[model samples]
Target: MRFLPILLSAAILAAPASAALKDEAGITEGLIVVGIAYEISRVCPDIDARRLRGLSYLLSLKSAARQMGYSPAEIEAFIDDKAEKRKLEAVARDRLAGMGAVRGDVAGHCAVGRTEVARDTNIGRLLAPR
Candidate 1:
């Protein structure tokens, strides 16, 4: 009976350390942030994707996730998951839309991109002036 309390306490303390990769905000949100930068650069006339930095950031995320116990297959599946992709894309689209992006208006996207760039945000870190 005495050992039971200690066991429960140990499990409680250990639970958070073994948390899943998907729950890690840095890597997961980094994907969305980087994706936003890439999309903005794609449509924004004055913006360009920082190709090497983007690639390196992604690689670092993969490495960090793996270090946190995520398997390569698991990471790939998360990255490729259609549902997750749609969800993240929707979020990105909403963010851009909120910043004045319109379907056919490159200028709007450019403005948003330039603003993000000027702010030096996570999204802007993946983009550069064209």
Candidate 2:
């Protein structure tokens, strides 16, 4: 909740001027991944410790790619590379498993809340590639 707002604000403020040059859908997916990661980190830290860390790494890669002025096509090519895709998929799988194992309604709460925050802020769309 508190963290979500802060994260969204930071993401918006820290975006590079060339952010618009990256793929919109790709960025959106990355943002969603980051949100889910954050939620898992906070709500189910004991589930899969590496899941959040891995997602943070992926977000960094995207941020770096944008800062380096990579076009949307180039960014997508890098992210979609077999090796990179595998890493992403692995992290996603781990996160999903964690969500399933979490106790009580924490997982549901985190998912719904984070998703609403992401959608309301439109952080991904704001950085849509040109």
Candidate 3:
């Protein structure tokens, strides 16, 4: 949906810069997680993101990647890579769609967010009632 592309673009901007990170699975996964939480929070009026937790999680992801020997430049370059950005965006979009959140469907997104929060899913943990 239109909303989804905006979310994906936001996620891409927030993602690492540069070409691509070297085999950093956590970084990729973490970005997707952030993107998912971000989308749910974006479309759900009654919900809010665990902003501090999300930021902390993002920082930790970067830190972990650093520990794993990926330089800041490498991580940045990875995300800056158009193909990599598209790949991550596609994954995030698919994940949301899989959960029944579609473009222009506010109710669907809210329902999914509520369900996730109620179920205490990882995405749920990153969201809460406003």
- Candidate with best lDDT: 3
TM-score of each: 0.77, 0.35, 0.78
Answer with 1 or 3, whichever has the higher lDDT.
3
Cα error, candidate 1, residue 97 (Å) = 1.3
lDDT of each: 0.67, 0.45, 0.70
Task: Write model 1 residue lDDT over 1-130, tens digit each, in one string.
Answer: 0111221122112212222565778876876776677777778778988877877777788788889887766776666555555666676677777879865578987888888889998877778987
Could you tell which candidate, 1 or 2, scores higher by lDDT? 1
Which residue runs does candidate 2 get wrong by more than 4 Å? Answer: 2-23, 67-104, 107-130
Please provide, for model 3 over 1-130, each residue's C-alpha lDDT reduced to its tens digit, 9 standing for 90 to 100.
Answer: 2222343333333444554363566778877777788788888798888877777776677677678777766654565566665677678878888889976678887898899889998788888876
TM-score of 3: 0.78
Query: After superposition, which runs of candidate 1 have C-alpha atoms over 4 Å from their true positions?
Result: 1-20
Off by over 4 Å in 3: 1-22
For all candidates, what are the clash counts?
0, 0, 9
Please give the range of 10 consecutive residues that has the lowest summed lDDT in model 3: 1-10
* lDDT of each residue in 11-121, candidate 2, tens digit only: 333322332333455554664465454444455433322343444545575676667676645655544344444544455445544545233456563454344345643
Look at candidate 1 and give me any clashing residue pairs.
Answer: none
Tell me the alpha-carbon RMSD of every candidate: 13.8, 13.3, 3.9
